[model samples]
Target: MTLMASDTSADVVIVGTGVVGCLVAERALDAGLSVLMLEAGPRVDRWRIVENYRNLPPSMRLFHWDAPYPPKPWAPHLETRVAKESEQYLQLEGPNARAYLQGYVRYAGGATWHWAGICWRLTPEDMRLKSLYGVGRDWPFGHDVLEPYYTAAEYAIGVCGPSDPALQWPPNAERSKPYPMGPIPFGPGEKRLTEAAARIGMMNLPAPQARNSGVSYHGRPPCCGNNNCFPVCPIAAKYDAATALPKIEAKGGKILANAVVYRVETGEKNAVEAVHYFDPNKVSHRVTAKLFVIACNGIETPKLLLLSKDDRNPNGVANSSDQVGRNMMDQPKLFAEVELAEPLWTGVGPVQSSSILNTTQGEFRNRYAGAMFRMENFARSPLGSAAALKKGLVGKALDTEIRRLSACTARLTVEHEPLPLPINRLTLSSKTDWLGINKPNIYYDVSDYVRRSAKEYTVPRLQQLASELGATSFQLSPEFLNSDHIMGGCIMGSEAATAVVDADCRAHDHQNLFLPGGGAMPSGTASNSTLTMAALALKAADAITAQLKHG
Candidate 1:
């Protein structure tokens, strides 16, 4: 198939039609800028989405998994080098290491199609990590600067929650408006845990989720509370990028599906000129734009910039600082399952309904930790519940154990703060994809802080709580843990050497190129990254609008 061009140019061109990209497109259109969005997946339809979810293999039916689809011509092969088991403890290379991690949605709606809809705001201290804790570098701007944008994003997405004083951290920002909807009602399991946590001097509160509890302002229906949130939502109750695409289109923006962006093009002075993309048939096309925004996730965003190398910029486009793919970080997540002594009603509502703020503070403060416990209701699916029981009980005694403790299983989730490690990074591989563009080679490893925090600080406290809650037994997963909330790889800072983009999200070397996504986060916070990504996009959009008007 031959590649064809649409209208010659747009005011802004965004790559990746995921949650962040859709938010950026909508904001740009609202600013009266002509926008074009390129997605590497097929257009999504409601019926097809349901079918796709139903077809997923049972093993891969987790909330983060999306339906299988043909990969774009430029997509990388699923094969990669796996680190040896002996090297796992090296803190750099290991058997579980992922050579290329690409988790973005290929469908028109992106990953939001199957997300659990947990929305959270990064604590104020999250903004100045380097300055406050001397760990990760500080963001050029603080939470104060992002407060208004956060308000805008929450309202636009119809978030539901009440501000909890206990969960509030230092350097807090003011909210200009309230949540668009009310919070989800707490289930019996959550109520028991909340009461238990408070009895133990822990502050437990309802989780602020993006799942709608009532008619949304954006025309989507309320959530049906179908225990299945991952893989894909059969109903449009959860907020997804698709909901925002229509608003962008209404403002005259264009979204092109199955368009895989390869690399950015630069002019004589190294100014961003255009973005090159390959169609499903592997035919290359170029779209010129006054400005370009890379909303591709953490890994692909830097990979694209690195592959745009030329004689003028040997390292790559906007590589003067050599920080495009450095400082990679993902949340250090831990899971603990406890068998309860009584029936707490484990099969209702979303799995993660409430969280405790006690272990998140004090000596663990520097470690950056938070614990969220959901009633085992997430395991309502027969296959999922049986798997959990088997994994927890172990051996041929599993059947006897299931009958012995049928009503007593609850799970606790602990998300630890993962600081950005300069050594843990992303680089371009010599191997090229079908479009002749280099693939991304990710080098990620958990840090000592993450390991110690999970073992010393998080686990002990969780064990104490489980015992207090009358848990007969408890077990923890051994995976190092990667979160749906991927961040860094294109960190933002005041200086160019340590960061790729500036406080406003513009590339340090090329002012016309903006990176609006979790990739620009200086450090991964304990919250879901989608809401924060939208807020940052809104801030960047405002900056872009101001620059265009002034210039």
Candidate 2:
């Protein structure tokens, strides 16, 4: 619902209605503080997105998940499917330009609307990268500090995974409690891959997913194996932020959709007083609050900070260290398509049910990056059918080829952790969107650390795994694809000179402002970074609660 003029002032003003923002709002409202959320995209419903998918042409439907959730012209996001289209938003530069065309939907819910729902927590060692690995910076605190918050985030998002410690993703990290729901059973493909990985002395664990498993939890339904978790979940079995908006409203929180936040206005003592946003018709509105937060993902959060320059902070708000839009990161992934000799039946469960955790850490990280390998559990029928038809095979021949490829084809991906580099960054582009807001331009390259991991560690291991599966052909990707876990633009550290935010994700330069999300992550571990981002949000929420109470 749109916020009225009287609702302008709040205890907390959150920019972005994504999962991170929604969680923060939930906690702050739970503390009896009023919250006003500003979202750039329109409020959309599940049925509308499902119908949009159904209305697409067969070819477009096969590979174009982004087509269903078309971005509002005023709030455009990255779309790789049609990179040359009118609303190609994210401006890419550097040699690895095309690789950064991330597919995150800009709607009321944000990217969680289309995520695979795999939630992997960061390991204790992952937090202390500098002390242990000597590669990247360490977090201000360790896993023990964030473990309780991780448990809270899992329950908040309705995550289900194996209770067995041996079956956990980071098999070494101690768990305070079991997952919210029972583990999802392994499918035939996951079972086969697990066996194959075992032969190579690796561990394949059932991935912790935010989707419900057997029974409904937190208002979401159980997973029915619809296999449509990419573009949108047809059922409400998966957790997304859209589901949280109404709950926030019911608790006296206000949300304004199609409210594009442009500038952050500072009042005194390096405090964020108010924010300026534009409506869909380019009508400007200002909302003031005691505290402010920017949770518009990694790219937009940094871009917004850079755009909010003022007299005291001429460089930008909270950018005294020049760390607002620097040290950009994403998990650079390597793809391998194997034509196995046996049928795997991959589409029996969620899009990503399991992953090999053996390569995620070791003493070898000092030289190269860590890798997490997993099976791409998307159904191969439509993809195989489309490819066969395009090759002039029709009727019986097409049917035979489609069945063969669908049953035997298995795609494996290895996600490598790239160290945060100041050179790899995002800047406001000279070009502007329809709203006259400067677009984000990125310069990124997977450093040689990641390349060395692929060459020395992951590639050889993937080949061995493919051979163990008795593959006919194993083809490796020539270039890296993004895991879409954008991170490190507004990095967290103990010192103000080196980091944008502190351990609590509160801006070091502005005590009353917080930038909590993947962008606050200091190191981009090989796992899906959502759980860590959620945990950070919860931690930030507590900090904000304490500040409001004692101050």
- Please tell me which predicted candidate would have the highest lDDT against the true structure: 2
Q: Write the per-residue lDDT of candidate 2 for residues 509-541, one digit (tens) a residue.
A: 898999999999999988899999999999999
lDDT per residue, candidate 1, 141-247, as tens digits?
76778888888888777777765434432213367776777778877777777787778777676767777886655777787777666655567777775576777
Give the residue spans of candidate 2 off by over 4 A: 1-6, 80-87
The residue-level lDDT of candidate 2 at 294 comes to: 94
Worst 10 residues of 1 by lDDT: 81-90
> Which pairs clash inside model 1?
63-230, 340-408, 346-377
Candidate 1 residue 130 Cα shift, in angstroms, is 2.5
